[model samples]
Target: MLRKITSLLLVGLLLVGLLAGCGAKPEEPQTEEPAKEEALKIAMVTDVGGVNDKSFNQSAWEGLQKAENELGVKPGYQESKQEADYSSNLELLTDAGNDLVWGIGFLMGSQVEQAAKDYPEQKFAIIDNYYENPSENLLGITFKEQEASFLVGYIAGKMTKTNKVGFIGGMDFAVIHRFDYGFKAGVKHANPDAEILSQYAGAFDKPAIGRSIAESMYAKDADIIFHAAGDTGNGMIEVAKEKGKYAIGVDKDQNPDAPENVITSAVKRVDNAIYNVAKDLKEGNFKGGTNITYGLAEGGVDIAPSSDKLVPKEILDEVAKLKEQIIAGEIKVPANKEEFEAMK
Candidate 1:
C-alpha cells in the first residue's frame, strides 16, 4: 500500500509538471521597434496674389512642394485673398507649430516682423524685403530682378516688329523699379531707336486693369509687352495671344501659360530659394536675422528657355553672352532709374 501511494504521488507530480509545460511557452525576448521621427513641417503665407498667381506666389509654393516631395517635409500654405489676411494667416501657421513660416512678398514685411517679435521662439522668413533691424528669428530674402529682366528685355528689343515695346507694373515700388529700369536698359542697349511704353496697374490682382493697360500699349503700336505684374500679368499674356503680339512672363517659366504668345520669361527662382532655405533648416544649418540676396551670379534669376520657333538662336546667343558678362561683373545692370542714369 505504501509503494502504491508513493508511485501515485510521483505520477501525479509528473502530470502536473507536464501540464505546466503545455500551458504556456516561455516568452521570447521582446525587441521593441525604434520610434519614427516626425516629419519636418514648413509652410508659407502667400501675398494677395494667392498661391496660383502663376508668378511669385506660385513659384514659392512650387518650392514648398519640392521640399515636401524630396526631403519628406510637411509643406503647407495659406493664400491671402487680400493684404488684411497676412497676419492672421501667419499666426495661424505659427500656432500650428510649423518649423518655419515664410511670407511670400514684401507687402508682408511689417506683419512678418511683428509676428517674429510676437512669437520670439518661432522662425520666420520673408521674400523681396528686408529690415534694418530684423528680429533675431527673422530672415529676409531679396532677388536681383534687374539682371533677369534685362535679358528678356533684350529679347523684346530684338523681336519687336514694331520697334516699340511696353512695360506694365503692378506698382511703382522699389522692387518693380528694378524690373522697369533693367528692361529699359536692355532695350536701349539692343535697339537704341526702339521706343518703350510704360504703365502701372497699381494692383497685383487686378487682371482687368492689366488687360486694359495692355490694350492701350498694343494699340499704340507696341508689338511686345513685358509685365512684372502678378496675376495682372496673366491678363497681359492673354491679350498678347489674342492680338498676335508677344509677351514676356515673369517670376516663373510661363511658356505653358500662353505657348507661342509668351516668347520667354524672366524667371526669378523663388522656388529654388525657398527650397534651399528648407533644406538648410533640415540640415540644421539655417540661421535667422540675416538677409539673403540672389542674383544671376547666385543662379537666383535667369531667362526662361527660348523656343527655337519663337526666339531665334542668334537672339538667345546674344542674351547668353550678356548673361556671362553680368556673371563676370563685366556689366553692371541698373536696379532703378537713378542707377540706370548713372550706368555707363
Candidate 2:
C-alpha cells in the first residue's frame, strides 16, 4: 500500500510539470509598426547660389520651408556647387520618388527639361524660364522682374544724391539684362539726368567681386546700387552701409542686417511662386505643361518700402501712384533692353 501511494504522488507531480510547460510556450518575436508618411514629398534643386545666398535661392527655400511647416509636405533641397551638378542634383531628387520637384533659376532650364523628359512620370516646375516644348509633366513660373526693378529704379533715380545709380548683375544672362533695361528706363523716366552704371559679376555667388564693383561705383559717385547678384548683392548692401548710401534688394525683401542702408527692395516673389505651387498641388489643381507669368497686376512682383531716412512720404506716394498706373494699364513697363531703348 505504501509503494502504490508513492507511485501516485510521482504521477501527479509529472502531470503538473507537463501542464506548466504547455502553458508557458516560448515567447514570439516583437515587431514595430511602420512610420507615418508626410502629406506630399517635395524636392528642389538649387542653382550654384545654394539655399542661403540671401537672395534668389534663399527666397525660394524660404517658401519651401513655409510649405513644410504649414502645407503638410516633406521638403528636401539639393544645392548645386557648380553648373555641372544641376542635372545630377535633379536626378537625385527625381529618383527619390518626389511628388513635385522644382528647379530654382532659369540657369536650370535645360537640366529641368531633360529630367522631366527622362522621368516622364515626374512633375517639375522651373522659375523664370519656359521650355520651347515643355513636356506634359513640366510647369514653368516667370515673374515680371523688370517691372519690379523699374519701380525701385525710379526711386533710385529720384533718391540719388549724386545723380548716379548703378546696377550690378550676376552673370550677363538675359534675365539680368532685363533687370538692367527696365531699371534704366525707370531711372531715365524719374531723373532724366541720372547716370546709370551697369556691370556683371560673371558669377552668381561672388560677394567679393560684387563688393569691389559696388565700391567702384560708389567711388564714381553712384549713391545707390541695385543688385541682382545673389550673395553678391548682399556684399553691395554691406558696401552701402559703409558708404552711408542705399541699396536695392531683389527676389526677396532683403532689408538685411543693415535695414537703414536699403532705401527699398525691388521685390520679385519667388517665395509666393513656390508656396502657391505646393498649395495648388495639394489641392489637386496642379497645372503641368503650362506657364504662369506674374506681374504687379498679379501680385507676383513689386517694390518694397523704406522708412528710416531713405525715402520720404512723397516718394512713397509717387511709387504707389506709379504702381497703380502699371496695374491699371495706364503705364506700360518694358520687358527687355530693346523695348526700353525704343521707349527712350
Number of the top lDDT candidate: 1
Taking the candidates one at a time, how many backbone clashes does each contain? 0, 0
| Model 1: CA > 4 A from native | 1-15, 18-24
Shift in Å, residue 338, candidate 1: 1.0
lDDT of 2 at 127: 87
Model 1: lDDT equals: 0.92
The candidate that achieves the highest TM-score relative to the unseen native structure: 1
Compute the lDDT for candidate 2: 0.87
**Cα deviation of 79, candidate 1, in Å:** 1.3
Which digits, one per residue and each the tens of the lDDT, describe model 2 over residues 277-313? 9999999888898899999999898876443356887
For each of the candidates, the C-alpha root-mean-square deviation to the true structure, in angstroms, is: 2.0, 4.8
Tens digits of per-residue lDDT for model 1, 1-344 = 99999999999999999999999879999999999988899999998988999999999999999999999999999989989999999999999999999999988889999999999999999989968888789999999999999999988989888999999999889999999999999998898899999999999998999899999999999999999999998999999989988899999989898887998889999999999999999998876988999999999999986545589999999998999999999989999988999973
**Model 2 quality (TM-score):** 0.88
Candidate 2 residue 170 Cα shift, in angstroms, is: 0.8
